[model samples]
Target: MNYTQNEKIKQVDEKTLVVGVDIAKETHYARTFDNRGIEYGKVIKFNSTREGFESFEKQIKEIAEIIGREKIIIGIELTGHYWYTLANYVNKKEMMLVQVNPYHVKRAKELECTK
Candidate 1:
């Protein structure tokens, strides 16, 4: 099965900043949200590497400035033993890491659909 990078982020618009990422062996999908939870941009593909870190740094800086906050919260579905690298990167900065259950995300989607 094949999946597009943008398919990972659901219900994006221009509100409270949120990013949905699908962790993969090679690359990941990223979607962004604004202060009001509205997505106002494109979903781009990001790889896990040195250059990837550079790009992520630039984006994170922009996000921090937008919200006037030094810290950001990043959530990823816990993939047991494989996402340590990504977790480390977030932990090294003035940011927080959240573990989300895929089940919960699905439930939320269901609720949103009913709304």
Candidate 2:
């Protein structure tokens, strides 16, 4: 399915919790945000193992419950080949996982650094 930028933006609503994950070879970092781009909690650092994925899942669920959101959309950066296992894990856990473009992350990092 193809989605325009506006269509993609419209998917997130007040009942949604968006989690962006920075994938790495051994570890990953994640942050949560609401529909309006307001961050919800601290950065979570978890390993790439099954245990790590479980922990990440718990964190996401906890945040959603705390914020009273019923939907979760996890966005993961497409970094190397390390994402397969994590993707499978997330899918098995019945949550939506969206692959994000690395270029977008790069540009965001550049903007962050300059600020």
Candidate 3:
């Protein structure tokens, strides 16, 4: 299932909620965004433990309900082994998880800052 950039972009629509997470060894930070890149809530800081994942899931569900979006796509930077736990948790929860390139994320941040 290979997707071109355009196809990948098309996957997000008005009914979709995108979650971008910055994974760390112990804690993770997440933000919710709409298909047009508008943020919906504050940054969520959750630990890497199961309790933390549960908290994260709760927040995501609340946000989605508030925003009236049913589809969730969680994206995380593909770092070290720290992301494995989160990936598995997201999979078990039956949500779509996207692994992003760390370098690409860094470069995008740099470009954003220069704007």
Q: Evaluate all candidate structures by whole-model CA lDDT and list the values in order.
A: 0.63, 0.92, 0.95
Question: Over 4 Å off in model 1, which ranges?
Answer: 1-16, 64-71, 111-115
* Off by more than 4 A, model 2: none
lDDT assessment of candidate 1: 0.63
- lDDT by residue (tens digit), candidate 2, 3-33: 9989888788999999998888999999999
Per-residue CA lDDT of model 3 for 1-115, tens digit only, reads 7999999998899999999999999999999999999999999999999999999999999999999998999999987889999999999999999978889999989999995
Model 1: weakest 10-residue lDDT segment is 7-16
lDDT of 2 at 94: 89
Residue 51 in candidate 3 has what lDDT?
A: 99
What tens digits encode model 1's per-residue C-alpha lDDT throughout 1-115? Answer: 3436464343233333566666777686666655465653566577777677567767856865775544455667776565677778777765556677989988978999994
Candidate order (TM-score): 3, 2, 1
Error of 3 at 101 (Å): 1.4
